[model samples]
Target: MSYNDRFIRACRGERTDRVPVWYMRQAGRYDPEYRKIKEKYSLLDICRNPELAAEVTMMPVRKLGVDAAILYSDIMNPVMSLGVKFDIVPNVGPVVEEPIRTKRDIERLRPIDVEGDLPHILETIRILDRELDVPLITFAGAPFTIASYLIEGRPSRRYLRTKSLMYGEPELWQLLMDKLGDMVVTYARAHVAAGGKAFQLFDSWVGALSPRDFERCVLPVIRRIFDELADLDIPKIYFPGVSSGELLPSLKGIKADVIGLDWRVPIREGRRRLGGGYAVQGNLDPAVLTGPMAVIEEQAADIIDQGLEQPGFVFNLGHGLFPEASLDKIAALTEFIHRYSARQLQNGAAAKEAERA
Candidate 1:
């Protein structure tokens, strides 16, 4: 309505009228308007123009009535400041011009100068901060996921090249992770300073690693990113991406206020694995939206039911929404989450009052 801080309240583990719902990649190819814009401007092109980028972001908040607005920028947007060359190919994803293969390549990464090199990104945040009623979630890719592209040159089915570098050149991998971690902290801090209300560190590919490797090789940098930003008053989120169920236990003591769960694990089980002390977001399979509206509500009902069992929960997809994802379904699902969860909350309160009586 006026200003929805429901998402922020849930993240801080505070009381909310209902569970807030916002999907990853909520503002993308899924909408026809965005598709038209995509034909004219590349994802990077839109991001480089703050006005256009802010519009792309707010489209979802207006259309679907989402609880928050994630910035319409890619994780690799900051890497250009670090002097990496990559392109978000039409269907291929991030393709590195020169994959970081040696100590030389890793060392070659300069520190990010966000205001100097990425003025447009900050401008986009400033625009959204003034425009939107919802909190603006600005994000960066976590080290391992960015390194997966930097090392592998492109997305790999097995991430063999990424692991080979991690296993064979442990010191080199650590160096790369350190540099990337620094990039994320700088980039994220700049966003918050530039008027971003909250932040999310997307470690999308980190789920590919075993829990042992995640702890030994990746978790330190992940922990450091949050620790560096611990002073910020706004909510911080770490989404360990799809298939990250096994890596949950290894993520103990991460300073994030919210931990995102992919759909592979149930919400309660994912929370159980986290061992407490953070609000939980997501685990809805985005593919479920392709089915009938009745089917969609049935599935969303299960996630909301499990979510309402706990104090801090936000309704979201386990992963980003795909191009084929229906706008109508998403809008309807948003309405369903708000209405259904409100009634559930009211009923629960009534039951508790009855017990007291």
Candidate 2:
């Protein structure tokens, strides 16, 4: 099967020729060619340039042979289009000008004009569909992650503003979350319409909340977003970061087709907790790519082995690729998945056939 078909099938809990491998942030800083392109254009600038974004998006697929090409854009792009002032700092992540601290602040936020602020993203997806041979996985921040930045106005080690509001001003927080969920559904549907084959919702900060807080404040909004997109028939990958095992049970009622496991959660444990109904993606440490080739190979093999126990698995790093990650290691890791994963699948199938015989 082709990579696109294999990936979509994997997401749907259907049998495929092999486990498909792709990477989070596979199109960015790890590749030297991407770095060169970034020098000529800012991250946001390139994201808004359909030609340039498409070129960067296809780089990792061409170089590392990943099964999917994620669109070259940051999660904050849609948030910015929602009337928030933001900037992507050099080493730092996103910084927003004002956080929504009160009910008035939440009410002040406007709905995003998907066509106006993100026309280039649509154009880039169009180009990618035409030029790339693999699946195109577009992404958006889950309501909680986007709300974290909007509430904190920047990356925070403590996420104090976010929690304070969640606890102190429950009504306001709910309103804000509801608005963000609406934005996610709108943005995601637009991406699907623009030719993206699948979507991944990055709830990068959900682990920051306690299980009670997560259930009360986060899951409902996430469910609404996924529920809204139910008719799209595209695979929805939900990635909740850092020790998110506690949140998995709450996801059972959500509409996501795939649950993305971060490095902190073991894939086996994740599958067990999440049950057998949905596909699971990731759980490999991105830091492993910075280690020796042998170490990377061993770790990659271990992750693939764990993933095989599940019906649907997509090979990926737990999080985005680090800027300092070794490109050679990534290339080796990709090739390893393509070769070793396929062999393992073939062996498993043969064993099953023999057992039946």
Candidate 3:
């Protein structure tokens, strides 16, 4: 139960020997081993295979020396059970076979049968729990993000169709959100029961909405999901990617255990705006990992220094890892975070002792 409590402690807003570091997409093509696997199997193929998925999930923890392991599966995986046909088109991202629009479309959506429909994913979590020394973070796409894909049918620069559904047909929007919310909760709870140490709900495209729109259309469903999961002892992380600083005020109503910040927001300022209560994760620019070691160290150190001021903080990139990012640089960054955080904590302890004397 106490395998790697450092990440868990940080999630609980407790001090640790060193700051825990884990990249968002740590098990992707950046790792040569994963690249080899990709050569043989497609992304979705690998995710469907519990044995392979478990192997990929553990690869990053073993290679990069991260403090935690996130389940290596796509957020769209759960939607397949909802009867929404989709494809993880190689370079284009998720492509829905039939985009949802009308009230009938929402009615057609089915509830996810986690154990019966997604047994492989649950088995993958079980394998990771039995093998990994660090905490395992299971994840699901938040209702809004999943809705964007469902409505737009693919990745979008402007979620025009998604917003149309929300603004034009609020009733249909609520119906869709209600269905997706239930699916997310069901999928996430099954993951926890199987052996996940924590849960992360990725609202990756939520920034596309204005604060008013988010408060009106998105907040309630997200609140419902977290409120449903509040009974679980594991920390629930909410990541609303990019341009989310303006929406932080509305996020206050969300009941997540940890609020993850994208690189656009400074950790210190995010803490101030978020009211400094719940644990926070991330805000590091992932591009910094490819820069010179000197620059990387300088930038990472700045984030670490500011993040240490928070009651609970976990070190992570603001976004997922880039395929072109250097593994050597990531390894160095991990080592530096541990060394730097350890020194900082030690100095704080010494200063406190000296003051006491």
Candidate 4:
């Protein structure tokens, strides 16, 4: 009932009554209400209306009672400011109208004009800040991930064109990463200024690179984005997307508050790889939600237990929610994480007190 900062506290590695929970794509088609709204208005259409966008963003907060509310927006939303035209095609994902291939195309990208081009987005953040009980996480796609879409022109499985450019045209690749990094730095500043309580940089496709290639190609840009935002006091998160376990050890001083783990690595192990400098979030397999309720609780408890072993941890899916994921199951899972972790924490505190006595 009261304003809950459990999510925020966890991000800062503070102890709480329980492990806070929020899914990656929490406000999605899985909810019957969201589906009904989608029938009336497209995802982009909903985003253009600030009041409606804010309401859609809060749907899961009211329904499943998540600890944080991520802004309901496409990562591509900011690219329009860079003069790229794209569409979020139904069932396919983001599709670029004109793919960037040449050096001139990369140079053509302008610094993002957030207030001028995406006023509705900032307005939505303002509305959510005034209304929500939970922290709002405004996000931007990391340079590599955004570059993947912009280069490939659509949802890609192999990213052949993207990698060809990265490996073949190294100088050209740096130029693109630089501009995209600049856009993220500028865009994120605007979100925080507009009242976003926290920020996440979604590098959802960066895991595609080998550790050597990622470090050589993308890590500099990643480092710069977080470094530029170091003045923002809110928690910052870096989700390196699926299969990113191998990429963790290289993130030594990226300045993010949390490093999101895919289910490929256990929470404790992921922290070890990250060298324990930052708080950790996620690694729960989102697919486990489609299984039996018992399976869901067991898996969630395992993650929560490992999370409770440390001070800074948040409960969340390893990745985005599936469209067919059950809403009832998600709501039940949230309650389980809250109730079970709270009891576990209380028991541990009592044991410590007894020892002191």
Count of backbone clashes, every candidate in sequence: 0, 0, 0, 0
For this target, which candidate reaches the highest lDDT against the unseen true structure? Answer: 4
**Model 2 score (lDDT):** 0.86
Model 3 TM-score on a 0 to 1 scale? 0.98
lDDT of 1 at 216: 96
Worst 10 residues of 4 by lDDT: 1-10
Q: What lDDT does model 3 reach? A: 0.90
Put down candidate 2 lDDT per residue, 1-357, tens digits, no spaces.
Answer: 243578888899887777788988887787788888878888999988899899988888888877888999999998777788898988888988787787878898889899997798899999988987888999998888888888888899899988899889888888888889888889999999989999999998899888888998888888888888999978988989767878887778688899999887788988888866889999789888778889988988888899888679998888889888977888888888878988998999899999999
Write down the TM-score for model 2.
0.97
Q: Which sections of candidate 2 miss by over 4 Å? A: 1-4
Ordering by lDDT:
4, 1, 3, 2
Q: Could you tell me the lDDT of residue 122 within candidate 1?
A: 94
Candidate 1 per-residue C-alpha lDDT over 167-237 given as tens digits, one digit per residue, 9 for 90 to 100: 99999999999999999999989999999999999999898999999999999999999999999999999
lDDT of 4 by residue, 63-88 (tens): 99899999989899999999999889
The local lDDT score (0 to 100) that residue 251 gets in candidate 3 is: 79
In candidate 3, where is summed lDDT lowest over 10 consecutive residues? 246-255
